[model samples]
Target: MKSDIRVCASWREHHDRPVYTLTATCPACGGDAVNSAPAPYDPTDRYGEYRRALKRRARQ
Candidate 1:
């Protein structure tokens, strides 16, 4: 059977360093999970195609 996807973000404190997290999961199966986010796509650097797509979205 198909399962719905879940996404989560988490972080740890008690330190001076900065940290970030992203996660994806399938709730139908407790252990089924994945990381579905891109590796930090900077909107400012993507000056051609994706940027136009983003700008079009902003106008809407």
Candidate 2:
């Protein structure tokens, strides 16, 4: 299951530090919250092209 943790999207404007919460809105500022985790894949992955090619081949 996805984690319940989230961070305020406008944390910089609302607080001196990031505001983490389990809800969809920041407790302090009532602003929208976003998942705090890093993306599952790296954008600079060297083998990403090869992986995409493999998936494309499998699709056909």
Candidate 3:
């Protein structure tokens, strides 16, 4: 089966320390979901091109 994809709003703290947060809006009902990661989070999907794509989309 195919999994659903959710678009999210995300941010990172880049001052003294760097932390990442991602929050998604439900496409069906407009509800919100969130996730957070400490420094050195997964560099694959968490910090990789996919995350960059999300951030880029959010800016537009």
After superposing candidate 1 on the true structure, give the runs of residues whose Cα lies further than 4 Å from its correct spot: 1-27, 36-38, 42-50, 57-60
| Candidate order (TM-score) | 2, 3, 1
Clashing pairs in 1: none
**Whole-model Cα lDDT per candidate?**
0.43, 0.93, 0.43
Error of 1 at 51 (Å): 3.7
Q: For model 2, what is the alpha-carbon lDDT of residue 5?
A: 97
RMSD of 3: 14.4
Which number leads on TM-score? 2
Error of 1 at 13 (Å): 36
Best by lDDT: 2
Better of 1 and 3 by TM-score: 3
Q: TM-score of the candidate numbered 3?
A: 0.26
- List, residue by residue over 1-60, the lDDT tens digit for candidate 2: 466799999998879999999999999999999999887777999999999999999999
Which stretch of 10 consecutive residues in model 3 shows the poorest summed lDDT? 6-15
Q: How far is 14's C-alpha from truth in model 1 (Å)?
A: 37
